[model samples]
Target: MLWTLRSPSVRHLQPCLARKLSFTPNSRLPRITKDAVREIPPSTSFREQVARSAAPKSFTSEIKTPPVRNQVIVFLVGSFAVYSIAAEQCNVETAKWTKKLSGSSLIWKVREPTSEELRKAKRLELGRKLQAGLSSLKDMTEGWSQTMRGLAVWSYIQVFQPILDAGDGKRTCWAIGGVNTLVWAAWQVPKFQPFMMKHFAHNPLSGISYTLLTSMFSHRSFLHLLFNCMALASFGKSSGVAASVHLMKEQAKNPHGIQETDVTWHFLAFYMSAGLFSGMTSHVMTSKVLYPRMIARLTSKAKPVDAAAVAKTSETITETSEKTILPSLGASGAIYAAVTLTALAFPHTEIALMIPPSFPIPIQWGVGGIVALDVIGALRGWRFFDHWAHLGGAAFGAWYYNYGPHMWNSVRATHLEASQKVQRPEKTD
Candidate 1:
């Protein structure tokens, strides 16, 4: 009879009754009323009845209050997240990639430094100097003054003067000016020479290796810097270096305009990569072939020994001379690369020579003549400059001019596809 009760108020008691009794209603149990249900003990063993008693008396009357502990936890978490992001300002992702790809600790992974990092580095340097010895406060101040002067002059000459005087707001001039400033600084500072030689020059014999890219900005000879700067000023602009005719045509035909900044970034990547490729070529030749041959020739001449004996003697000489560091540093390699690319892009364009018989010649003809001279010089072992480097640079320019664009596009497409796949949800069975 209780099971057949139709009162909606008694529905809450159904679960408690089900737990207390079997499938059949018990005859001994008292009938349930709203008042009787309300009178149920708060500490009841029956779960439903305990839950009903524990529930809020009124949903609207309950104050909206958040836990202080929860608020404190969320604030701490948010602050930590912000701190982590800020701390990663100098993220070394590119450096890590370079190190991983090269598989060499000899070559330093280089990146452009920010102002904060530069200041910190200077502080460290000054602190170390202070710890070494204290000559005089006056002397320290003077030294610091000189350093500041040099830095100010360099920055003014490179980044500011060009922008102010050129009257043209182009990214290329700023880049060129900055490089020129570095070249000038490298030449002027005696300390810089040893630093560059040890760390920046790509010498297989040297323990330090970042010189592959740094060498592109190095030029000890004033004439060399002048020549490279002239060539760069002529062709380093966006109009000349940023895009090929084919790229320009595509941009023109497309509805959306391509960003010039992207092109500039791509050109920078090409230039740095070209320098590394050129350096690698020279390193292989000097370390593996040229150095050994020189040793062999000297060994043979010294004793007039048998060929096998001479070879053995040369090996001995090489072992003894292993400590000798051989390094080639200059921007000629990268400069030649730019020249080759420019010539290939506009074969009909005329280039003027700085030396005698100075006349404008077709770019293709000029580049060919220069390349031929380099090839001859390399074979003959001319030590005036790195002819092998020139050849390597030329080869890189040609290769990049042909396949670089396609490769870059393909890489970007593949990356975009991968990202899309990751973002898309999986299908259900």
Candidate 2:
């Protein structure tokens, strides 16, 4: 009988009997079946393949961990929920019952109209009416624009209420000039105010060149005057006077005497020149050859039908318009001058503006930027605004700030020399 060893193989040397021995048919030893010992092909079924490829696992088993990806997603979702809830709550509280949020669409709180609120609202409305009526009356008295003057006065009050009852001389001049301009030349007034525009006007021969000091009062609207006055009060009042005084005191101890009145004169010049410069810049641009093209186009009635022709025409018109057709209106030039002077004189002071509401630009940046932009606009032949006036006003302000002290000292010296000569102790001449 043939037997297969299931244990480790051992080398056995049986007595060297016959090489091949056969067991008796009735031997008790168990026989190994060929089927059980036969090799079987690798189990290629899905289950068996998967089992073979799998790594050996310990019986202790593995403990699963929290997924990192899942943790991040959960955190983001939670944060979003908090933000959404906060926004909703704020919106709910801010919602207006009356349904008016100025000129915008945002919801604002509707406060129950209290008696005091009603009274205040009524007073404000009445005050505006009274101001209007008073301005008209004042206009009659002044023989110029009394209404615009009132607005300028109000603006000054608003801006300089913080300083004192008496604020600045330049601001006062600006207010006066604005009133004069509104009544005298009415081309720059906004729609909300009167629009009696200035017509073609000049003396018969050698007409006013606008270089005249009186030309400062030439704005089109009362509002223009108001804005300039406000700027002057806010900026000029704080700095111009203080700087003039400081400079005057400093020069008092010097060999060459200085005059406070001489230094203070530029305050008047700044107010007057800024307005005149802006108007002159606009006038010059308007009078340019190409400006007539823009005016003609703007005033024309019929539209061109040809696409190619229209395109070419539009390009020409744009080029021509940019080359001319600019009118510099408004008191922004003057206001910017005041702002520049104020910034140069008081480098660290903060300024507030009420023009756009809720936001204030820095004085230095605001003044310098306007001047620079005007210069660029003028150089580029832009047709949108009067950049020349802006540059002129700002330049005047800078020059005045730097040289005012010296000029004042020179004037004082001249005055001293004249007075001493006049008061000379002369004997027999």
Candidate 3:
């Protein structure tokens, strides 16, 4: 009777078996079927084959084994590619409500508004005013024509056109435009003024948590919005290019491999959190040091100035929260974060300032100079801008550049492993 051994090491025991045993029909062994006792194939390493087949096929394996450098590259590259794609896909119409679920859908999607027959929208004066204008067919047609004309004018005036490859989806321009449009509208609309003041501007003492997010998009000044958008467009686009190059190189190695949305989430998380922390930094500095000093100075020097005026100033400062509460309203903090990140990601890239058109500076040097200026500004009590916020944002960008990718990968791996465990139960021997 013939028998087959399923062990991969069985081949190693062949000599021992040959010397000790002789197979005979009289031997009391169960016969192995011809199909089960097939001859070993020639020119094959059974051990290697078995090892490859039994290897873990989990995504965690893919993530956990990569070098630290590669992990960063993968994350940064993946994020850049996704950002390019996501930005290109989103438009003004969809951007208002199109949601991106951080790690899963790096892409933006508008949710279908649920039809609730039970509840009706409250009709306020503004809603009635908006509806009143659209009642007449002639007025509607005129409004439509005016809107088309305005769009044409906007298209003509747009400084940054769709120069990106169509495949990438020219979405960044829209985001920049949308932000600028909102800032412009806020200045023009009386009703929007209070909304902008409450939500768009960050006040540390306000106790509203969401101001951190909204403040990043709010700029009360036209110049502030214009300059920030310009910087974001230039540096952000350059950073995206660097990331894309890195991604393409990786894709070249494993053409069939799938990528995650980790990069997109990383960039976005880094951006938003940087803004929040930066704003908090400013708040800390002001509340702990700057505000206290101001109060002390006002109390101590009250006699030097016009006594009545000083008294009035001191009373005004004491009575109203506005004087004590410094409201920061701008995208400077977030833009600074992007600038520092871009400098780190592509240090050799040349940066040119609009003021000095003839001179070009290394990105790293430029970032260093900007950081130094912020430090000086912060120390000297320069209140022209939120220097503390700038420092905070820059610090975050540098830190994130160094360690963010590895941390991100580790988190993703942990999440994936947990999910795999939930979906697949281990078998018992």
Candidate 4:
């Protein structure tokens, strides 16, 4: 009895046969010659056929791709609006605190505190808070093992103490770094891996908005967290009001103004904006451009088996799996923004590479080199890092370095005026 390709007896062999016959599901079926039909052994059992055709399952199939939507404009507009509102609130609160501490409403109108005065006040307040925290920790750890106590103290000094001592910019960086560390720790649990990947990692195909922000604080590896945190700290410190004045020696030209009362909100706003922009950039490039190109190549006509062909095919599949299917997570994009901004703001500053232990090089050169590498990686389709995101962040940093200060000043002035109006007594008729 002859066995047709679609016969029940050979139904299990269709995929294998189709692959062997060089025909895809959507392609026209080629005529099977007598010789080709006889190549299948008549005695081959259905079980054996099924076994031969089966390949190892991949995690790709388990991940569901959500419907694509263009969210670039919406995300940018919404995020910036939120940032503006938060900045206004922070400015008002800072004004209130200044009034309370000085015991004089005249300070706001007569003479605002200088940056030096603000810095001293900030440091004193932080010192008191740090002392209180340390005392509490000492009491709590008194009963613990000596080793544990020593470790706890060491960790506190190494982490929290420095964060408190540093300027508000660096303090904010450490706070973000702390969150990243927690996320990294969570990823180490075997059972938590799946959940973390789904929630913490940003998948372009996932069509989720929250992950774009969440992934900024999600570092999968200790080294990644360490490097990014280190970079953030360096840039944050360099960009601080005090540090910039010291480095530039031109406080008169500083666009951030002399009122260094509280820039925590401003820095936080910039960081979040950079992260969202970078994440969106990666998402659009993958979902709108690279992803479609990948699918087309994957479904196109089969090529002959050769070394180059096999290698290219493997690379394509791997890229698709890593970028499109598997999610991307880390703080590199936001850090890149900081790095570029610092480089441009303080062009005379020197920086040394942490990984290679390079001698101090001008920051401009260092940032330029880093950005060039990213450009090359993006153009060459390097799969190790999300180069598009890095580039996006760098672009935002440069752009903001020029215009962000003016925009922030405008927002603060508007809010301050409104706040004063509210506080003013209404005229009696």
Candidate 5:
């Protein structure tokens, strides 16, 4: 009985022993099977992971919307401050002139000039200017070679002659156009493109402050410069004066209200203010609204499973924001302000288009059409021009047209009072 039981147990044990003997040491040592061992993936750097993971969905989730500051408020406040300071300086100069003209130490009170006297003086000054301009033209042409003379004459006729013929306000606009031409010329050079785009163009993404001002005088194309200069020349007359559009017709009706002073300071202040306001508007819209939408679109289009696709999507986002969105440079915004102001100031005035050489259309109609077009463009997401900026400028111009003259008068009055106080003689016992 013991032999039989032992034999059965040994038979079972022999099978188990055979199986164990069949397995080699290599097979027993963690069996290096594909599923048994964890294969090491190729080493990738952290930056590469981040760069490759820029799928719109992941990127949007990772990046919170950037905080934008209230640059518009700052620009508005600074504009007023600059205007006040300029008015004060002008009053100070006027006070000095008044004192000089008094010709008596006992005369402490400032004498306000009659409108008739001012008109006579302006006429006399105009005569003197014409005489001087003629003399200079004769002298300039006398010593030039034939080719040089022809070039100079052509330049003067096409450029300098109009500037010379323009009034104080229009002349100032021409000077500004000269600056724009210089910037445009700089844009023509191959090497300067990068520098020009970086410094002269207003890139909302760059977070630069000075570019707001610099970009107002920047134009990349000749047609752009020509159009802007033409508009500026047409509309950029001093308030209460005649221009391409009959601005401030109500003021024109009241001859006494049309006190002509040098409007250089005022025009400069308005132009800069409009440009800054418009730039800030564009910046805010781009940062707050357009950028997120862009990211969303990009994300929707990207394939998350493909690493290469993700990387390409990221590169496209960078290029769109940096190259396409950022480089807004022109005087269009400021010129829009001038245009709207002219339209509102002279509602019945007519203007002719240069491109098509169309017959003169009502100024109000032209402004309305352009503004409406801009509104539609903004709504439809047109990328050719900064429509928001144009709208902002238009709004500013409208606001200024209503309140600007009163504000200017208030500034002048305040400065004039302060000046009178300074010039007043102290009573002696």
Candidate 6:
């Protein structure tokens, strides 16, 4: 007996089948995805339903080639990147993680992570580590510049708060203060510096170093201030301020605390170290054949500019030749460190760059990529930007973070010792 076929299209339908059904010639479903199908009940007219829904999901099919997942990917990445860079550039904290639930028990039923979710989480974890590493690098920044940086940051925040709340002169504006903060940070650099220096000096006894912490108020220009203020409107204007104040209070309590004294020392250290590391890395690569003395010599004279300048001069440098090079300026060193910090803090977070934000990169990968790039820069001594500074700052940030808890403990112990000494009767002269 011969059985009659219901419809060849039903069994024969693959994503390849969508091609014949699709109206446009070069466009059809590429994957035979299960998501395209709904219910396939026994009583239902399954064949006709599949044909109808199988029609491409379109917003305006005739007018355009309809949006695809690729478009969605691009949009998500681009928007995320712009927000990330803008927020980071201005020193505001940006979003990076999503709330998630994970577990193995059905009785304790947990939300299973989708592929995108898992991918993002892994990226976030990686970013967090790198960012911490960057914080360790601040140890390398010079004192005055770091203080200037703090002032600039605070000023931007102050401007930002008021601007955010001004609300086109209508709604109760939250961003107004942030705008004010930026304005203050930009114009009042000198005033903030004295305060910065007074508060952040290093310990004489504990081998602890110090630098001014008011870099909270520095900005490169009016544009920098303006943009930072705008960003402060969205994120709370008080983030870095709170951190700075807390450090200051702690310093007052424990003179040997982690913040710093000789406000220019750490910043200067970072600047020189970055250049030095960059030069050393570069020398090692070119020298090919290893010599320990040569490496140490290169490292000792490692100013960022000399690292760059050394390439043109003879690779050989005597001790006498190192003294003449000029020192560099700018917050780029610490900024690079901060960039890495934000990247690691929110690795799963997305980033969109300025100039061209066609897409966003995952924060974790972004941090890795930038750090990797900096490493390559150190070795090659690229002239584009100070890759060594970036690496140096990142390294400093990580070190500081690791030492943060321990440093605080040391400060507390010193405080206790001093307090007991104060309570004890003074010896008569």
- The model with the greatest TM-score is 5
**Better-scoring candidate (TM-score), 1 or 5:** 5
lDDT tens digits, residues 86-113, model 6?
A: 2232111111122232443353245444
Candidate 2 regions exceeding 4 Å error are 1-164, 167-171, 174-208, 238-255, 258-266, 273-332, 359-361
The regions of model 1 sitting more than 4 angstroms off are 1-170, 240-261, 302-326, 354-357, 419-429
Clashing pairs in model 5, backbone N/Cα/C closer than 3 A = none
TM-scores of all candidate predictions against the true structure: 0.53, 0.43, 0.54, 0.70, 0.71, 0.31
In model 4, the worst 10-residue window by lDDT is 241-250
Please say which candidate is ahead in lDDT: 3 or 4.
4
lDDT of 2 by residue, 299-336 (tens): 36536457787567667655655444433345566665
Per-residue lDDT tens digits for candidate 3, residues 1-429, read: 999878768889888878845466555777888876577555659887787786555321222211223223333454455444433322211222222222224232243321110001111323455445434433445556777856654553353233322111123434654776677677678888887888777775565555656777777777777787777666545234333223223322332222332123334545556666677667667666776665565455444457688567756756554564577877677678777877877778887789447588788898899899999999988878899999988987777667655544444445545555777978999
Q: What are the Cα lDDT values of the candidates?
A: 0.57, 0.48, 0.56, 0.74, 0.71, 0.39
Clashes of 2: 4
> How much does each candidate deviate from the true structure in C-alpha RMSD?
30.3, 32.7, 30.2, 18.5, 11.8, 33.3
What is candidate 1's lDDT per residue for 119-173, written digit by digit as tens? 2343454456643443343344565677775665555457534433331113543
lDDT of 5 by residue, 95-188 (tens): 4444443454343345555333443444456667866866687687988788887776666557545544555667678788889999999999
Q: Give per-residue lDDT, candidate 6, residue 410.
A: 58
C-alpha-based local distance difference test score of model 6: 0.39
In candidate 2 the C-alpha lDDT for residue 318 amounts to 56
Model 1 poorest ten-residue lDDT run: 254-263
Candidate 2 vs candidate 5: which has greater lDDT?
5
Which segments of model 4 are wrong by more than 4 Å? 1-70, 104-110, 131-161, 238-258, 300-325
